[model samples]
Target: MDKEEYKEERFTERCDDKVESIGGDYDLEEEDDSPVEEVRVTISNTDDPSMPCNTFRMWFLGLIFTAIVSFVNQFFYLRQTQISIGYSVVALVSLPMGHFMARVLPTEDFNLLGWKFSLNPGPFSIKEHILIGTMTAVNTSTAYAVDIVILQKLFYHSEKPFIAGLLLVFTTQVTGFALAGALRKFLIRPAHMIWPSTLVTASLFRSLHAGNNAPGDEGRMTRMKYFLLVTLGSFIYYWFPGFIFPTLGVISWICWIDPENVVLSQLTGSNGLGIGTIALDWSAASYYVQPLVTPWFAQVNILIGFILVAWIMVPWAYYTNLWNSKDYPILSPDLFREGGEAYNLTMILTKNVLDEKKYEAYGSVRMDSFFALTYGVGFAGLTATVVHVILYNGKEMLARWRSARLENEDIHSRLMRVYPEVPDWWYISLFVTSITLSLITCIVWDYMPWWAVLLAMVIAIFFVLPVGIVQAVTNQQPGLNIVTEYVIGYMLPGHAIANVTFKTYGYIVNVQALTFTADLKLGHYMKIPPRIMFMAQIISTLISGVINLSTATWLVETRPKVCTKDGYPFTCRNTNTFYSASVIWGAIGPARVFGNVQGAIYSPVQWGFLVGALLPIPFWLLARHFPNVTWLKYVHWPVLLAATSNMPPALPYFYTNGLFIGFVFAFLLRRYRYNWWARYNYLTSAALDTGVAICGLMIFFCIQSWDGEMPAWWGNPSDKNYDHCPLGAANYYGVIS
Candidate 1:
C-alpha cells in the first residue's frame, strides 16, 4: 500500500483501540457530537463524577510545586540563556509525589469550617492530578510586572516600595481572570475551540492514570516507564552542553570556517543571521518554540516567515544602508548614537524624564536595522491576528455570541455542565477589586495618570477575544507589547516608568486572560468541577505573584552589578531589552526616532500596520474560492508574521534549530512511525524540559554559586560567545568607539 493508505488504516486502528480502552457507549466513528478527530483520539468522552479533586493532598502538593516553579523561573529570568519550566515538566514530576502521598498520608476525613475532606485522596485520581498541574501552570513563568520592577530599580535608578510592587504584580496577574470568566461561552463552550496544547496535557494525564495497556499494546513498554527512562537519559546528556562543552549549544561550523570575514561570520553566526547554525542542546533549541508540541503546519509558517525576514529582507536592508545600518552592528538590541557608541541615558535624562536641552545635543536615538524592523513586524502581527480571526472564525464566533447556548454541544461540554459553574458575580467582583487597586497603585505612586490606567484596561478588553481565538486555534500568541508601547509612547512621552507600567497593564492583562481560559479548557477536558478550577487558579495567581516579586527583589539587593554585562551569566538579557525599549519609545520618545521631528529616518516601517491588515485577504479569498486546495486553508498569516517577535532575546539559531527538530518529530515521525509518535512524542518533550531544568539548577548551586568556573579550553571558550564569531558584532563602516 501507499503511504497515505497505510497512514489512514493505522489511524483507524488507533481510534478503535482508544474507544475500547475508554470503554464507553460513545462510538468514535459515529458520534455526531464529538470534536475533531484529533481531540476524539486523544481525549475521552466519558466522565466519573465520584473522583476526588479538592483534597488536602491536592492543595499541599500543588502549593509546593507552585513555589518551587515560581522561584526557579524567576532565578533563570536574569540569565543570558533563560529556560522556562513549563507545566508539562510539573505534570511529570508531581505524579509520583502525589501517589506516594496517597500511600503515606492518613485516610481519615477532616472537617474545615463546614466542608469535609480526606488527607489521602483514594489513590489520586486524574482530577487531583489536573488540579496540581493547573496550579503550577499558572506560575510557570515569572509575573510580567516583575520586569517593570527590575527596569525601575536597575536601569532607571528609581525603586518603588515593596507593597507597591506587590500590588502591581497581583493586580495585573489576576484582573484577566475576570475577563476570562466573562467570555467563556464564546471561547470555551464550543467544540471547535479545540485549544490544541490542552489536548496534549489531557492525553498525558489520562496515560499516567491508565494502569494497563490495550489489547494491541501488550508487548510495548508503558508510557510511564518510557518517560522515566528518557528523563534520566536527558539529565545525563545535558552536562556536556550545559557546562563541560558549552560550545555544543551553538555549533556554528560555517563561522568556524572563516571567523574573521565580517560579512560571512555575521550571516552564519548564532548571534547574527544563523544561516547554517545547529544546536545539540535541547534547552537552547526548545527555549523559544516548543518543537514537539507545536503543530507541523504552524512550524512551516514560522519557518517561512523567519527566512523571509531574517535571511532575505534583513540582509538587503543592512547592506543597502537603510536607516544608516552600516554604522551599527548588523543584529543587536541596544540603542546607539549615530557614531555606533551606546546611548548614554544618564546624560540625556533628568530625574527619569527627558531633558530637552541634553536630548537636542545628543542627536537622534538609533536602533540597528533588525531591531527597528522587528517592531514593524510586531505591528503587522497584531493587525494580522485580528484580520485572520475575522476571516477564518467570524461567523462561528458571531453565532456563538448571539445564541444563549450552542445547539450542538460536544460531549466534553455536556459532561462539564454536571458541576456548578462559577458565578458571574465572582468574576465581576474580582475584576472590580483588581482594577480599583491598579488605579490606586498607579496614581498614588506616580506611575501614570488615572486616565492612562483606564485606557490601558480598555485596550486589554478590546483585544482579548480576538487574540485568544488566534492562540486557541494556533499555538502561537501574537503579543500586544508593541501596540501598548506605541500607544503610551505617543500619548505620554519622556516618562520611562509610565511607559512600562502602561505596557504591563495593557499587554499582560490579555496574556493572563488567555492563560486562565486555556487552564479552564484543560479542566473541561479532564472533567474537573468549574468552581474548583476557579478557586485553584485564583489562589495560585495570588501566591505566585507574591513569590515572584520577593525573589526578584532579593536577587537585585544581593547581587552586585546584577543587570550589567559585568554580571557575566546574570547579564539580564531580557531586562536589558526591556530597558532599551523604554529608552526608544518612552524616555527618548518615538518622535525623535521614527517621527518627522528628527527627519523620520525609520518612519517607513509604520507601513507594516497596513501591510498586516491586508496580507490575510488574498489567501483567505483564494481558500474560499478553491475549497479543494487543502494547503491554502493552512496559510495562517498571524503565525507567520509573529514568528520573529522574540528575535532580540531569542537568537536566530533557536528558530533554525527548533524548526528542523519540529519537522523531524512533528512531520517525519508522525507520518512514518505513527504508533511510536502517538505514544512518546509529548512524553519526550516533557522529559527533556524537566531534566534540563533540574540539571541547570544543580549546576548553579553546586558548581557556579561559589564562583567556580569551567576550566578554560577550546570547548569552554574564554570569551563565552560560544559561536566564536567575534567579527559578527562589528559594523561594516568600521566606526570607532
Candidate 2:
C-alpha cells in the first residue's frame, strides 16, 4: 500500500487509549510552550503463521546472498567508480528465490542421527526475507580493515600474511557491532528513535507478504509488477554505457563540439569543472547518494551545496588560479609538490619515519585547490554537524533519554515484548572477547602498543552516543575518520603502521556501531526476534571481514598498479585517497603540514574548522527569534557542507544529474502526483539500482574486463578521454611537470 493509504488505515485502527503505546512516533521535549501535534505512522501488523524465523531456508539464503553481496562490495570498493548491491536488491531477489525453494524442496521433517530438519520449511516467510536482507546488509559495505590492508600494500609497499589481515578485519568490525548491541536500550528500544531507511525495507516486506485477498493486495501486486518492468528495462539499457558505448557514461557534448579547445574542455570535460556534463552511468551518478533511499528533503540541502561548490566555486577558483590552481589539475584527489609533480613521498620519508632535513628542502606539500577545498568543506561539515545537533536535536535527544528509562512503549515495541530480548551479557561477553583479539592482533602484527588499542576503543565509546543521536534523527553520519586519524597521527607521529592501526579502530568502531544499530532498528520494525537478528549480523560481519580482506589481497597482488592513472576502471581512486590521507595524516603528520604557517599550502584550510563551528550560531539565533521564517528550517548547515565533501569521489556530473533527477521526482512529481510518487518512487529506485548492479557484475565477469585489453576503435579511445576532450582533460589524472 502507498504511504497515504497506509496512514489512513492506521488512523482508523488507532484509538486514544492505545495511541501512546505504539512504537514509531516519539515525544520531543520542548523548551518553548508551543503545542505539539501528535503524528502517527502505521506499519503492517499482519503476520503469517506458516513461516518461522531461524529456519534452514533463512540460514541457507542468508549465507548465499551474504557471500555474493560481500564479493560485490569488495570488488567495487577496489574500483575507481564504486558500486554495490543495495539491500533492496537482496530483498527483491531473495523473496522469489525463497518461495521457489519452498515449492521444490521437501517440507517433510528428516531425522539425521538425533536431529530433525526440513529442507523446505512451510511457505517462504517474511521473517526469512528479513534474515537474508539483514545478513547481506552486514556485508554490503566494505570492512573497515580493508583500508589498513590497502594502505600497507599501496602506500608502505608492504604486505602482511592473509591470516593476520583477516583476523584484524574481523576483530575491528565485530568489536563495534558488540558495542552497538550493548547500547540497544538507548538506540534501538525506543519507538521514536526511527531509522528512516528501515521504513523502506519494512514497506517492501509488508507488500511482498500480503495475503492474496487482503484489502490492498491488488495494489501491492501492481507495484511489484511495475518494479519488475523497470528492473528489466534498466538491465537491458545499462549495456550501452557500461560496455558497448562507454562515452555514453559522460556525454560531454560541449567537449565533443570543441574537442580541440583547452579552455572549453576545462569547463565541460568529466575531469574538469564539468559544466553541462551529462552522465548516463548509474554507478557514477549514485556513487555517494542513493536517490531512492534518501528523503528529498535531505537531497535538496545536499544539492544546493554541491551546485555552489562544484558548478560555481571550483570553476571560479581554477580560472582565477586560486591557491596555484593553474599549476595543478582543477579536479584531482592527488597531493602535489610546488613543481606540479605527484608528491614524491619518499623525499620526506625514511623507513616510514619523517625526515625533517629532507622535508625542509622539499618545502611543504601542495594540494590541488579543489582537493584542499573539499577537505575544508568536510571540516566545515564536521563542525556544523556537532553544532546543528546541539541547536536542533538537543532537546529531543534529552527527552528520549529521559523517556527511555520509563515504562513507555509503542505498538512495535509492545509486539516485540513477546519474544525474549537478547541479554545484555551476550553483548558484553562479545565486546570483551573481540577487544582482546583486536589488541593481540595489533601488537603482534603491526607493533602497535597495547595502550593504543585501548585509546582507540575509548574514543569510539565516547563518540558513539552523540554520533548515534545525529544519525538517528537526521540520517546523516558526520564522519569521525578524519578526526581519529589526526588525533592518532599527532600522538604517534612517525609510526605509520601504528597511526593507521589506531585510526582504523578509532573511526571504524563508531561506524560499525551505527551500522549494527541501523540493522537492529530494521529488525524492530519487521518484528524479527532480536536474538536472531544479533546472530545474523555478527556472523555476517565476521564473514565479510575475511571475504573483503581476501579480495583486497587478490587485487593488490594481481593488479600491482591498480590505483595508478593507467589502471582506469581498476584505478582504485577511493583506495588512492585513503593512501593519500595516511601519508598526509600519518607519515608527514598534520602538525608539520598545517603548523608551518609560512610555507604550508593547506594553512588556510584549517580555518574551516573555526568557520564551521561559528556558522551554526547565527542560524540558530535566527531560528529561535524568527520562528516564523519557514526557509530557515531548511537551512541545514552540516548537510550543505557534506554535499561538497563528495566532489573528489563523485564527479561534478554526479551532482548535476543527481540534482536534476532528484528535484524532478522529489519536488515537482512529489507535489503534483503525490500518490504515484509514493507508490512507484522507491520501487523505481530499487529496480533501477538492482538492474544496473546485476548488469555491471555480468559485464565484468562475462565480457570487456576478462582479457584486460580494450578493443581500440573510434568509440573506445586509448588516451582515457573516451569522451574526446582536449589535452587539458589529461590533467585530471595528474599534471606532472
Candidate 3:
C-alpha cells in the first residue's frame, strides 16, 4: 500500500466497530492523527454549552500577554543565542492565566446598546485559552521587516523616520495576515488538511481541561500527571546545558582530543560545520527542526539529505580547497576577498551605495564555498517546491478547490458553517489598507520607489497561493526572499535600501499570510468564532509590530557594536547574517555575482534552479514505474533540499540530532510503544522547549544583561564555552589567511 493508504488503515484499524456506532455524530476517518484514543471524534460537532467566546476577558488577557511575549521575544532577538517563546511556553502559562480570569472575574453580563460584554460569562472555556495562545503566538516574534530596518541602521549606518519604520513593519505583517485570511477557504476549512503541530496544541488544551469530575477519563488524568513530571524534570535538566555546565551541550570528543586541529575542529565542533558531532543538549537538537512540529517521514528525508550534504559534500569540498575554501572559515555567513582579508565593505560602499571604483580595486567578492553552496541549495529547494507541488499535490489541491466551491460536507467546514465568517470584504479592506500604508511608508522614507512597492505587493499576492499550498500540504514554506532579491537586484541595482524594501514586502508578506492562516485553522479546530479570531490576530499583530520596531530602534541607537564578535550575548547574529544577505543580493546586485562574463566566479551557482527543477522528476518516475518499492515513497527530494537550506543558522549537528530523535521517538517508540508515543511524544517536546526558554530568560535577566558573568570554572571553560570549534574564532578580528 502507498503511504496515504497505510495511514488511512492505521487511523481506522482499531475503530471499525466504534465508528459504525457513532454514525453521523462522529467521523473517525476525518480526525487528525491524534494520540487521544477516542474512537469517535468529530470536527463538525460544535455543540458547546461553555461560556461564549470573545468575552472581554479574552481580549484583556491577549493584550497583557501580547506585551509580555513581545518584550521577551524582541529581547531574545538581539541576544547571541536566538530564542523565542514560539508557542509552547505561552501555551503552558496562558492555560492557567486564562482559567484564573474565568474563575475570578464576575459572571455578570452588561449590555452596551445592543451588544453584550462580560468580564466572565461562566467557566473559562478551552476556546478562550486558544484565542489567548493564538494571539500571544502572533506577538512573540519580531516580524521580518524589522530585520531589514535593523540591517540598514547597524550595517549601512542609515536610518528611517520612526513613523515610516513602524508603518512598514505593520503593513508587511498585516498584509500577509490579510492574504492568509483570503486563502482561508482554500487552506483552513478541510478536515483532511491537518497541521500536525496544531494537534499537539489541541491535545494540550484537552489535558488542561481534564478535571476530576470525569468518570471514565483515568487515562487523561494519568497523562496530565505524566506531563507535569516530564515538564519538571526537563526544567531541572536544562540548567546543565543552558547555563552552569555548558560543555555538556556540545560534547565533541574529537574536538577535546585534538583541540587545535583546524580540520578536526571544523569536522567535529558544534560551532563549525559539526560534521561528526553529538549534541547532548535538547535545545541544540531542536534548534534547526522542532521535534514536535515535524513528522517522522519529513525528518527521515531531512536526515538522508543532511548526510549527503553536510557530512559528505562539505568536508570534501573544504579539504580539497574548492572555491579557495582553505583560506576562509569552513562555515560562516561573512564575506572575504581572494587575498584572505575581510571584504572591505566600507571601502566598496559609499553612503550605502556600492562604489564601482572601490569595488573594482578591491577585486571580486569571495564567498566560502559551502556558504555559497547553501544559496545554490536554497534556489534548488525553491524550484523543487514548485515542481513538487505541481507533481505530487496538484490533484489534491484541485479536489480541495472543488470541495470548497461545493461547500462540501467536510467535518471541519460543516462545523464552521454554523458561524458567520469574517466576510471576504473584510480581508480585502485590510489588504487595500496595508498596501496603501506600504506605498506611503516606502515613498516617504525614500526607501523604495512607489512603483517598486506596487510591484512587491503584486509579487506577494501572486506567490502566496502557490507557497501557501505547499505549506498547507507539507508544512514546509519555501521562501521567496532569495528569488525576490534576485529580481530586485537586477531591476534596481545599486539601491540597497530599495532592494531590502522590495524583498521584505515580497517575501515576508507570504510568510505572515501562512502564519495567520495556521492560526485561523487552530481557531477553526477549537470552534472559536471566525470574527473573533480575525480581531485577536490583527490587534495583537499591530501592537506587537509597534513594540518590536521600537525595541529594534532603541537597541540600534544605544548599542552601536551589537553584532560584533565581542558583543557576546548581544552579538545580533541574525542581524549580521541579514546584513550579509543585503550586501550580497542588494549592494552587489545579481550582475556582479551571477553574470556569466563579469562574475564568472559565482555565476555557476545560478544553475541550481535548473538542477533543483530536474532532480524531483526522477524520483517521481521511480515511484510511478516501480509501484512495489515502498522505499521510493520516502524519497521526497524537496524535503531533502529544504534540509540543506538550514545550514547557515543551524549547526551541522542539527540534521543528525533531528535524525537521532526521529529514530528514538518517531520511528521506534511510535511503532513498538505506540501508546507511549501517542501519550508523551508531543508533551516531551513542549516540556523541553519550555524548559530551555525559561532557563535562557532567567540567565539573561539575572546575569548577562547586568554585566555579571558566571565565575570561571572547569565546567565553563573559557577556551571553548558551548562550541568546541575555535579555528574560525579569529575571523571576527579580520586576520585572514
In terms of lDDT, which candidate is strongest?
1
Ten residues in sequence with the least summed lDDT for candidate 2? 11-20
Off by over 4 Å in 3: 1-44, 110-116, 189-207, 210-229, 407-411, 414-417, 554-560, 719-724, 728-737
| Residue ranges of candidate 1 with Cα displaced over 4 Å | 1-42, 111-115, 190-192, 403-414, 469-477, 733-737
Clashes of each: 0, 5, 1
Clashing pairs in 1: none
Looking at candidate 1, the ten consecutive residues that score lowest on lDDT are: 12-21
- Candidate 2 Cα deviation (angstroms), residue 11: 32
Q: How far off is residue 44 in model 2, in Å?
A: 4.3
Per-residue lDDT of candidate 1, residues 1-737 (tens digit): 99766544333321111111233333434464464787889888787665667777788889999898998899888877777887778887888898899899998756678555567747777888899999989898799899989988888878989999999999999998999997788778877778888987887788778767576788899777888888888888988888999889888899888988888877888877888988999987887878998889889999999998898889999999998898888888888888788888988899999998888887778888999999888888888888887888778656644542555778887776666688899999999999899999999989999999999999999989877776776655778888898899999989988998999999999999999999998888887778889988999989999999998898889777888756766778788889899998899777766787756588888889999999999999999999999999988888889889888877888898988999999999999998899888988998888788788888888988777789989888887777787766678753323
Off by over 4 Å in 2: 1-40, 44-51, 212-221, 708-710, 726-737
Q: Rank the candidates by TM-score, best first.
A: 1, 2, 3
lDDT of 2: 0.76
- What is candidate 3's lDDT per residue for 23-132, written digit by digit as tens? 23433363433322331242334444123566676778888888877876787788654556667666666666777877788876566785544666666777777888
Which pairs in model 2 have colliding backbones? Answer: 21-410, 22-410, 22-411, 23-410, 23-411
Q: Per-residue lDDT of 1-737 in model 2, one digit per residue for the tens?
A: 99767544333221101122335533333331111111133354433212367677888899989888888889887776678887878887888888898899887776678655567656787877888999998788888778777777777867777777887888888988888976678777776677666766777777677765656445455766887899899999988777777888887888778676767777788877788888888777776777656678889888788877776777787778777787787777777877677788888878767787888888777767788788888888888888888788889878866765663665566556655678889999999999989888887786478988999999999999878866776677879887888788789776667777788898888998998999898887677777778888888887777788888777777764687878767887777777777777777777766656336667677888888889988988998899999988889888888887766756777777777677778778899988778777877887887788788788877864566544766557766677777444444333333
